[model samples]
Target: MTIAARMDRLPVTRRHRVATVAIGLGLFFDLYEIFLAGVLGSVLEKHFHLGKSELALLLASAFLGMFVGAVAFGRIADRLGRRRAFLLSLGTYSLFSLLAAFSTGPVMLVVMRFLAGLGIGAEPPVSDTYLGDLLPPKHRGRYTAWAYTLAFLGVPAAGFLGRWLVPEAPLGFDGWRWMFVLGALGSLIVFALRTRLPESPRWLAAVGREREAEEIVARFERDAGELPEPVENPVVPAESGRLRELFVPPYRRRTAMMAVFHVLQTMGYYGFGTLAPIVLVAKGFPVVQSLLFTALTYLGYPIGSAVSLPLVERVERKFLVLGSAVLMAVFGIAFGLASASWLIVACGFLYTTASNLFSNAFHIYQAEIFPTALRGTATSGTYALSRLASGVLPFVLLPLLNSAGAGVLFTVVAAAMVLVVVDVGLFGPRTTGRVLEAVNSRVGATTDQEAR
Candidate 1:
């Protein structure tokens, strides 16, 4: 199907909100587990007596697994089904997280982390694609933001769990092991809840499973009233799924741009998140005190999301992306340079607020830019690149942190954030409040003409 044609079928109804809540809960746990890894890093270091490089390597291993999981399961989600793929990824991570709790050495831990990354990496794209497809263009940004808000809940929850659990190391295991075990158990519970949720109607229709799609849509309507009218139908027949769609014509440049943006953004965000506690420790705070500060910094995430919920509709998404990127660059540097713990904590809070805004907008922007036919693949493909970059930065930055200190490390991240602001702001087309079909039509036409 042509991009324009594929977009005309987005489901619009109150059910979108219901579906969003259900899927958003799944995302919450997914993110919770991913962020928990940073805290777990400190515990693992002490437990295994890992040097800086070894810790970095373990992080890199996980990202490598995430990269593979994202790209591979993304295609699977698109080809197989979003609902099935969602459960698969969730189950994969939950199982591996339990395995991680039992790891006896660095090698075993790395292996389990890699496996878990596969599941973690596949989630956002699938969830974003599903949520985007469910909501109408008019409400897409707000609904998308709502979905992300749930995911960001995991950030603080991770900190809370770390602060509370990391010190205990209950039942002959360290706190880090308990973190993994808790995550595993939580995921299993989420997986059971997900089984009760229905599949995406739009996805089923796109893949020519019209009967199944109608049944799902009927279920949604039964619960939530009527769906909105489709904006347009470009009238192209569906064909076999193609991986090359993302690289062809107009999509190629946007896809490439998004990939670079993802890489740089992750470098900045994860660079700060993963290293902030260590920076606090180096500045003279005790371990427990540093973890508390880390938790305080995360408190800004939900605040950022709550604030963005109402304002996202009023602003251009590209501008919001640019504005947040600049804030991240500026405050991230300030955070690294502050001598006073209070100042550092305040700056870290602002940094996370801006980071949350950037991520929330970026997730909505990227998923909307793609056609329904390839949304999962494109979003996941870009996310995989981002995860890979994030996975490697800690390893690289750890050495720099040891040699150059926090100022130099954050300075580099600040520079990367600046580049991302330029790339996304200058080149990205505005997507605020536009109909999905209209956006895809423009992108498709531009891509086709460029191909010629």
Candidate 2:
């Protein structure tokens, strides 16, 4: 049996749990940073006396940084290895987040946020790919969703912390500043935890370090104590795939599919996930009320992730993405039309839930479709384009919000989600139970023949 087949047949064990938690805990900070823009935007506007354009810039800074980080680290991880790339990404984000806390003015804050984003951007794609490399195919989506369930808790954590800390400086430091400090400190701790975890055995084997890969797999076998019969799979030659490979057939179509999915998905996902408070404030809620409502709405994130766990393995991933996108469009539009407070929260919560389902499905799908050699590069490159859209979103959406009201803002978000549905429905592959290499091999062979 090949090393990859042995890996696929292994049962869930302690290492899996520890690695998932460590990565998930680290993702908590990544998510906190992503959602921080919405929570901090109103406060910063008041504190810094920021104009609309300046507020947009502040909100977009980390996302812009994420764009650069994802693109750079994707290639780096594919070369240097996932462990090194992830550690550097987390460390860089942590250091800059701490710096962001001390900024004396908007310029310093924006710069700090942008710098921190470099780490933030690489995290999700790298982590997802890392998890994909580690987990068995049957359990892959479910466990990945498990990690995200823990990670999405950061939304409410950010929301409530903003509600509590943003309204008052407990020890004389600004509340918003304290948010950055807490996030940085928490991220550093996760970074330390992750250092103890092993690199992806699959990634090691992919890079031709079969000795290291075997050693790690041996450890997992020891830890697991007993294992099932190993299923044999044909090993595709593990040459390091280059960036240009993704632009070729099979991968090229998958890449294009994800590229469009990521770009459009952000507006719907971040529209409700990151910009909820902004929308609420525009709906005439006071800043405090907006934060509280946003926090309440964010409760759905972890819960939704949890709910998607069983469905992730049971349902076709592409269909999950499609279904969730449709729900988001519906709920987001409902949120725009809601006038009552409970109705507003209800709509917001539903939108958030659908957004996370969409998130988990796509995160797993993107990583699953590619060969491991190019996984990081492909995932991050396409994901970076999403970050670019995320950074550009506030600039576009905020202006639309100001002119057309919440109804129009979310209507635009709905329109984006509609496009996402069509893109994924038409082009995305079914990735529920297929072995990763087999999936790619079949895809490549089929596409190569078509090209002939």
Candidate 3:
């Protein structure tokens, strides 16, 4: 039996659940910093006397850090290992986040934020990659989807924490500073616990460590009271991962589709998510009311993720993504048009829920598309565009919102979703219930058959 099959045959158990929670926490903090930035914005502006442009620059700083980190660390992860890269990323972000609270001015704050972003940037793609490696093909979609489910909770966690902490100095330190400090402390604990996460046996096999890979899979099987199917021992072949392969033949189509997916996904995903409160305020809700509404609306993130938990395995990931994107377009307009507070929160909740479902689908899809050899590199390289688009979004989106109104803002978001629907609907392939190696092997078969 193939190592991938061995992994796929194993049952879901307590170990997988524990590891999911650990990885989920890592993803959570990555988002906590992201949503926390919005809460930090008004406070920083008042303190630093930042103009609209400067605040955008500050916001973009972390995203730019993410862009660089994702691409650079992606290659590093592909070369080294997922576990090391995960810890490195978590530590870097945590340490720098703690330092961000100490910044004396805007310049210092931006630099620290940018540094922290390097770690932030590496984590989601890496966590997505790592989780993909650990989970079985049968259970892959929902297991990884559950991680994002937990991760999106970070959005509301930030909202509630920001609401509680951003009003004034805690312990005579800025409330915004306290937010960073708390994120940093929480990350440090997760970093230490991550040592317990088992290395990806799939990655081990791909890198020519089949014995280690088999042993781990065997351990999982033993725990399930079932030994794995027997296979003759042979020295594993090494994977010489080629960057050019991604742009060639079968992979190129997937590469292109994911590129378009990530870029288009980010415009609405982060733009609305991080900017929710601001968007509500722009629509004429009072500041306090906007914060209250944002907190209420954030409840939908976990709700959406939990909804997808069971259905993820039941449905096709491609269609799920398309379905969620369509709902996001519909709900964004509803949110913009609603006048009463309850309607506004209702529409916003729907939008958040759909957007998170969109997030879970693509996050799983992108990682599933490539071989373990190139999974980190391919996913992160494409995912970087989302990071870059997210970084640049505030620059374009904020201006559009300020100049036009929420109507124009959401119209543009809805327009972007149109592209998302077409791209995934036409080009995206189904990946449910297939081993990663087998999935890529079929691609190889296609190319060879075409060549013949």
| TM-score-superior candidate, 1 or 2 | 2
Ranking of all predicted structures according to TM-score, beginning with the best and ending with the worst: 2, 3, 1
Between candidates 2 and 3, the one scoring higher on lDDT is 2
Please provide, for model 2 over 1-452, each residue's C-alpha lDDT reduced to its tens digit, 9 standing for 90 to 100. Answer: 67899899988889998999998999989999889988889999999999999999999999999999999999888998999999999999999999999999999999999999999999999999999999988889999999999999998899999999997996899999999999999999999999998988888888899999999999999998889998777566545587777887667878888899889989998766767788888889999999999999999898889889989999998899999999999999999989899999999888888888888988888899888899999999999999999999988988988998889888889999999989987777677887888768854447534533
Q: What lDDT score belongs to each candidate, Candidate 1 first?
A: 0.80, 0.89, 0.84
Model 1: residue 246 alpha-carbon error in angstroms:
1.8
Regions more than 4 Å wrong, model 2: 235-238, 443-452
Better of 1 and 3 by lDDT: 3
Q: What lDDT is reached at residue 25 by model 3?
A: 88
Q: What CA RMSD would candidate 3 show?
A: 2.9
lDDT of 1 by residue, 1-452 (tens): 33232333444555666677777777888887777767667767777999988888777776788889999888887898888888999999999989998999999999999999899889888888877776766678888899889778888888888899878868778777888888889889888877876776677877888878777655655655444454464433343457787787556777888988988988777777777877887778887788889989988887788778987789988889999999999999999889898998899999999998988888888887777788889889898998898788876888888898889888999999999988986567677877655456654446434433
RMSD of each: 3.1, 2.1, 2.9
Poorest 10 consecutive residues by lDDT, candidate 1:
1-10
Q: Model 3, which residues run further than 4 Å from truth?
A: 227-239, 443-452
Ranking by lDDT: 2, 3, 1
Q: List the residue pairs that clash in candidate 3.
A: none
